[model samples]
Target: MDQRTDRPLSPYRHFSRADWARLREDTPMTLTQEEVTRLRSQHDRLDMAEVEDIYLPLSRLLSMYVAATQRLYRAQQKFLGTGDAKMPYIIGVAGSVAVGKSTTARVLQALLARWPNVPRVDLVTTDGFLFPNAVLERENLMERKGFPESYDISALLRFLSDVKAGRRPVTAPIYSHLVYDVMPNHRVEVDRPDILIVEGLNVLQAGRPPRDGSAVPFVSDFFDFSVYIDADEPVLREWYVDRFLRLRGTAFSDPKSYFHRYAKLSDKEAIDTATSIWERINLVNLTDNILPTRQRAGLILKKGANHLVSDVALRRL
Candidate 1:
């Protein structure tokens, strides 16, 4: 047997998050105490320390990737001797629901946007690419909301392709967390962004073969870099439940919120419902689809039970 198979996986070999304070030196911390406090109110346990530690270094790393991508684009432009406009440095952020993927995307967008050369950053979530409620209902897959089948895969692929091909002003549907659905009339337009961060639960999923056996490209194929946020299954479950309860008090209270039904549930009932949703949908998707794609990421952030990133896994160049 291989010795590697016998030993437990080494976390630090990925990227140790233990001494994050020190590694944060290169990244800027511009948020005021009030700003951080407000953000923390929404993200409760997060603080300036966590931002300085995990996100700071992460921002620095992404800056490097963005710079390199720009250089590559310029070099290709020079070689081709054509007037092709430079495309955005596209990043794919992937993880299970409630795994902090949205937070990661937002933070990265904020940090990357500050870089001198890449000031225009756009963040797009795959939630908008999900099939409409009516379609899902007709397909009898309302419960499979975040599953791969729930998406308009071809549309998502074309959108990424157009953005990567330097198309001007690509529009993607907007998903309202309050409504827990995509609003047909509301769409976000990304017009020649310097950096485009595409975040979703399954962005790293592999492409399926065409029924006619032709090759097909996946959404991830257009990414210059990718991130996978990971945590223990139980920790993730707890986070999901905790976030649900918090939203129950906040967004779920909105009369138009699709999850308003959940807001009325008692604490124990809410916990049971959260756990059931995890077991039935999110957890199954994570194991069957998301976790297997971790190795495909350029970097992976592993979180501990405390919801703080404990390790970073960067693919060996």
Candidate 2:
């Protein structure tokens, strides 16, 4: 058993990258460098070594969890004398903005789908659950776009409910980064998949309880497993600023982009603007809402500089 006291008083079993890599012994490396290159987010650095050292082991562990859950579900159904309807196993990925959670989700989706038992794995981002820009502007929540209150929490809960109920052809709203808003009349359909990954900054958060004393389901309540991607605040801020500058040259440069104005800014001016946004919005959200929920995750991926995961903390059973 690998154990450490680095997180003193914590309930998680810590593992360094070397120890974690050993857990994936004999697991084949199925992803190619080209595939990893395409899966990484813009300006994010993810290479084959990182995948082998960190994510390959993660995928193998998730595979075992999924299989065990499937068996348990079958046992429950047999005991209930119910038919063989399978519920999708949901995995929640939560973290601060620009912490590479999206990349992790995408990479896992690609890897898990290739597994023999998990032929269909879909990823749904909570970004889609965010209230439309028009609604946010009307409610004076534009400044708190990524905050928990800015999302359609009830709708998100209902969607998860339907998914857990094995509903087919479930549709979720589509959010566009280029437009910086949810696209009205646009939606993504999720058929019954074997596994579903829900990725967002608030996916691990516990929702506010209703006043009626009745039980209200939280977004995390639907997750079978949850992951939190973490890094030092200074490192995350630097990464955010670097990504912002890189995007200014690509996405922001497009005339139709919502942030087109940023494309014309000089390097120094862009850095200043990015820093301001981080300090004002992203940092506040991370400290007040996101970071507090890190301990709630079943597994935590702690990253070092250059976006490499240096350590992992698995929640003790």
Candidate 3:
């Protein structure tokens, strides 16, 4: 078989599920049924079985990468004859909204934690770096919530840069979904982790030169590895609409939610609203910004209409 296309993709293209299974032989699954159930509660469509099948092997592979990074760092230090602190292996996960990137990050964190070699695993979402709702409103960009310009990009880049540079006691702003805004006073600290997963919609975007023609560092530049979750636009549209309808009865019902007003709409009205939002906001952002960066990732997870990852495309090693 042309192993490159025969198996699920990774940074190394020729890996198969069997190959992954072999890599996972000693890797552990730390998540209990109760934990997995609790994790899946937010997205009832995900089950433990899917996690074991899709994520377990991937986490194992990441564990290996994490180990390899540590070894490389130690070797570089020895060659330089100077000691330096170990930095985090930063992983970037990018995808369209409702495309399951959050779930992927959480699952990988849980599974990667099970590897004894990796002591600490931290997951941070770029949502916290999003501009405050008031700022977004003033900029007339509340509708472009997940677009690149909606974020405090320099702040996000600095956080990743610090982490990769072995900086300690780094703190990032926290976001509240209820308020749909960045919480000014609240922050999440990373003293220093063995592995860090940064999940967001546009984390893989390339940097553009400044007006002075000077280079600027982008978030993806700090990534040790990156994954792009992808699917047909029509399929994503349907998924987004379905998730919106589900949230309308739940999170959207809470008065504090920015989308609370949506919960009160009738079924037909809700679907129309969801479709319009997708067409106007999410789809436009995906095409113009998100999808264009897919080739920059180390791996690509391709999903089917059922929302299952049916294909994998790994970049050439």
TM-score for every candidate vs. truth?
0.91, 0.97, 0.91
Model 2: per-residue Cα lDDT over 173-202, one tens digit each? 989999999989999888988999999999
Better of 1 and 2 by TM-score: 2
* Model 2: colliding residue pairs: none
Q: Give a tens-digit lDDT track for model 3, residues 12-68.
A: 463443443444565566788877766653643566666766678688767778788
In terms of lDDT, the best-performing candidate is 2
lDDT of 1 by residue, 71-154 (tens): 898899899997787788889999877778877787777767777664799999999999999999999999888989999999
Top TM-score model? 2
Relative to the unseen true structure, what is the C-alpha lDDT of residue 37 in candidate 2, on a scale of 0 to 100? 97
lDDT score of residue 83 within candidate 1? 76
Q: Residue 210's C-alpha lDDT in candidate 2?
A: 82
lDDT of 3 at 76: 98
**Model 2 C-alpha lDDT versus the unseen true structure:** 0.91
Q: How well does model 3 score by local distance difference test?
A: 0.82
Name the candidate, 2 or 3, with the larger lDDT value. 2
Q: Put the candidates in TM-score order, highest first.
A: 2, 3, 1
